[model samples]
Target: MRAIFPIVTVVIVAIIGVIVFHLLSFPMPWMLGSLFGVLLTQLIWKIPMKWPVMMRNIGLLIVGTAIGQLFTFNILIAMKDTLLFMFMLNIVLSLFCLAMAYLLKKWARIPFATAIIASIPGGLSQLVVFAEEQKDIDVTVVTFFHVIRVLFVVGLIPIIVSLTGEVPGAPAQGSSNLLHNLSLILLGLLLLPIGKKLRLPVPHFLTPVLIGLLLSLFKVDVDPMDGHLLHIAQLCIGAYIGLLLHPKSLRLPVRVLIGGISSAILLLVLTFFIAEGMVFFFDLDFATSYLSTAPGGMDQMGLIATALQADATHVTIFQLFRMLFIYVIILPILKWKILK
Candidate 1:
């Protein structure tokens, strides 16, 4: 009974979002609709909306499996061809983050640690957790900036893709056998625990994707999920993201809010330049390049790539590379230099 109102609110907002986006012919209507719908509702009413974590994990599972269907040999070959470029991009993005952090420290009057953590392009949750362990770092401000960055990227990238006329690909037609689809789904589910046990980032998404990729490599005939299932997955993910934007938690001065918004805009602009570079140098498509450079969560970017019929595998790989570079390399250096 206690959870009923929030659940109802989410459903109502999501329905409204779907209708609005559909009417407007928006790209990734279900996702963008639910995201903005709940976002607007939360902003206006200041409602306490909560979507269960398990529901989001379930959505990730579905989306991961769907993306995995694209892990064919040809895609793998293409990814290999671009491996060096991806590595360079990751390094360049890391430097861009550090430069932004310095600007924040200078202009925003943010403490060094907070600015550094907030400036980081990926690892929002991890950065927040790390900030909690540091002295004189405002976790609220860090979270505010991180949340705003993700919201800005997610909200805008799809619209840009739509404007560029990146049409959604034909819906996947997997094996017609129900049992086969069930088995693939179950396999993905079973891998979740292993991913968690291994302490992988975004285990719910990464585990299933890796499992699906392995199955694909072995020539296992996994069924692609229907379009309706994909929409449901998008709805779940969008609602979860919407619920994350707690305006009440952002107890900052107006100046600070302005600074945070500026930082987010700067990051978005840098992402756009990098993406364009990829297009010119690597000759990747607009959707793929934009998604690869977009500074949103890996799972969210992958979802957008899947929706836009971009190379999901390429997006996933690039995102994973950035995450790994940030967490494994940049984070340690930041800790040593700033925290110590």
Candidate 2:
């Protein structure tokens, strides 16, 4: 009977994965992977096993560092105008999300830690990586809300693009760039160990970007095209997201779901307007502006930009800026406020 549960759960999620892989692209595929794991845990393993902590970290490292491959000094030069506006907008949105988290924390009577963790704009696995220290982490609740957060943004991507007269995103030349890919693998392996040992603020998920930038500034060559190697890394990420689920975690109550939905609505509405305002500030098109600033998962947002055939490159650029900004800049500001 116990074995039956795990078996059925795996089968169902695998089928869901196939559908998601075919219909969805990039970051949406991450969500589909997450959803499958959530369902499997709910139906089968009611017993809690600790969230697969290492798998989660490795996945974050893989995807986050993979992101570094997308960068080049030329891109940085092009972003000068866009960067200033985005910096201000990300600050505003981060504050906005912080306020919403406080409100939800009060309504739910959950711990400040859980609220803050759930409130973080992107990187679910990274946030929850620290959640185990809680007296009662309520991993399910945190997981549920962040999951919905991505789904909300992803679900709205096609609709938003259509309204703005945008087409699906095209693949970028740099996405497969040899320099980016090589730098990523080396960056991933190098910084991950140091990140774990030093207990750094945001960990080494973005280590590639930081390191790559340093190397670029120093004019060092570290070119290697190996996204094919990234496939296993992606699956590792999927598995980490999957391991967070337990059989009972999916049985969320009505009030919690309602509150989460309300919070999500609050987040999306705020992100949209902020993104639009950023467009005016940067002289960008409507689609690029909105998506670039849409406060969500880095990869998922990029994928949405990719699918729409819009300025995904620009959108992705902003997302990267916002992520690095949040992880590096805002985190210190927040340290006293929460992270500490």
Candidate 3:
């Protein structure tokens, strides 16, 4: 019962955030509100709050399944043309991150390995674990850097998209039958363990997406999820991220803090320029292009795509390709050339 208390407290706080953001007409209120609510509460009050990893995994499952339903043969065919483009985009993004890492190393006087790992735009939890495993890497600094970056990217992107006055695409129709939707969600839940067993990075999220994509290719008709369920998922993820960075965990100098924030802002500026190039070359909307190029995790970008009614499949493909590139290719090179 004691363990359950903190969980309940956290949920209540997140819900309050949702309500406040909703009232304020904020973009992605359920997510941003919950994240800020929990984050600010913890920072100011230093409350003893705990959110379990299970909550985050459940959220990912819902989001992944919904995104998977967006897949179709037509979408896949459209994506085929972008394969080469995404490859080149990832290369550019990697080089840009390396440049940022170099600046961080020089400004903050940290090890190159730590700066590089922190600067790489990957999942926060995974990078934290990777940093923890390395010798002579400051996990605290890396965590601080990523925490600041993710916060800035997630907080800023939605507002920017909304400010452009672009309306979301029409939401797809789902079966009106509540039972059918529940059944479909259960089927997705069953895939969670299979995803875990695959030993892939972000298996909890990507596994459902891959399975959903396969099903969609074969003409399976999974539809968009109910808004309420999606809201809950967003709330879960937001709360998890909100609770991620405790002010107490950061003992670094003010210079490191400034450097981290400056790097995040610089990365966003660079991404905007690259996104403009994509808009010209690909003939895609600015929202889709910007979200695709933003230095954020696949899950966060996917969520933003869905919210903004952008081509989520396109964003997912680009983000996933970048993620895999970083993990499989870039990390290996860094390990051998730099970390060694």
Candidate 4:
């Protein structure tokens, strides 16, 4: 009962943000609005707010389930041709991120391990876990960098994609059947433990995605959720992100903050050039290629892809491949080469 009030307060504030952004015709109004709303309220008023990890997990599950349904038989077949490209792209992108890590190391005067871990464009949770295991690495700096970068990427990418032009196909119209979605939600819940047991990098999100993809391959009829559900998911995620950026929570030197922000911007610029290269080399549009390669959170990019009606199937594959690459190949090499 005591904790519930704060939760309800933030939710109400987040809803107001959604309403305001929706009125302004903003792209990703629910997410952007709720995110900024909660962030500003906390920063300005210092309101007591609390969003549970479970809320965020629920949001990821919804997003993962939606993205999973995108993997149709034809789409999977088409993705085969790009699998090699995706692998190569991850290597190149990781290399560039490492280079930027060196720059961040010098600019911020932080240890190389801390800089590299912070600069690596991997999942925040996973990166933080990695940082926690290492000696002399500032987990706070790593968390701050990723959070700021994700905030920038999430806030900017959707607007840029919206400004570029309309997405080619029709927007996804989610199923209206309550029972079907409820069953899917139940299944996602059941898989949670399995995901944790497997120790997948991002178990909540990836587990549902894998399940959805398997269902797709087997020709199961799970309707992709519509805007209403997506809105709720966005609200859940956005509000939490807003709280993460609560100004008081971050206590770092001005130089480090500047380095973190500038490095994040630099990464976005670098990603844009790579995205352009993707456009030139492959028969892909800028939006799909950009979102696919952008070193942001997979869930956030997935959300933007769905909103833009870009090749979400392609985006999911590329993002997933990058994530796995980071965990399996890149992190191991870093641990052995750098930490050793």
| Per-residue lDDT over 218-294 for candidate 4, one digit per residue giving the tens place of the 0 to 100 score | 87888667667778889999998888885844679888899889988888888888888888988788889889988
The Cα local distance difference test for each model comes to 0.82, 0.60, 0.83, 0.83
In candidate 4, clashing pairs total 1
In model 2, which runs have C-alpha deviations exceeding 4 angstroms? 1-12, 19-66, 82-84, 98-122, 125-144, 150-187, 195-204, 214-239, 242-247, 250-253, 279-291, 299-340
TM-score between model 3 and native:
0.94
lDDT of 1 by residue, 1-340 (tens): 7778888789789879989999988878899899999988998896767788887787888788888766776677767877788788778777877887888788878887888888888767777888898888889989989888888888889888778775446655645555665576678898778989998888888887888778778988766666677788899988888877786756687766887788888877887888888889887888889998888889999998988888788889889888988888888888788777
Predicted candidate 3 versus true structure: per-residue lDDT over 1-340, tens digit per residue: 9888888988999999989999999999989999999999888885679999989888887787778777666877878888888888888878988998888888888778988998888878888898888788888888998889888888898888788776466665755455655666677678767877887668767877887778877877665677777888899989998988887766688878887888889889988888888889998887899889898889888887877788888888888888888889998898889886
lDDT of 2 by residue, 226-299 (tens): 45544434444444445543434446776667766777778778877876775576666666666776756666
For model 4, the local distance difference test gives: 0.83
- The residue pairs that clash in candidate 3, if any, are none
Tell me how far the alpha carbon of residue 88 in candidate 2 is from the true structure, in angstroms, after superposition.
3.3
- Clashes by residue pair, model 1: none
Kindly give the number of clashing pairs for every candidate.
0, 11, 0, 1
Error of 1 at 157 (Å): 0.2
By TM-score rank, best first, the candidates go 3, 4, 1, 2
Better of 2 and 4 by TM-score: 4
Q: Candidate 2: TM-score?
A: 0.64
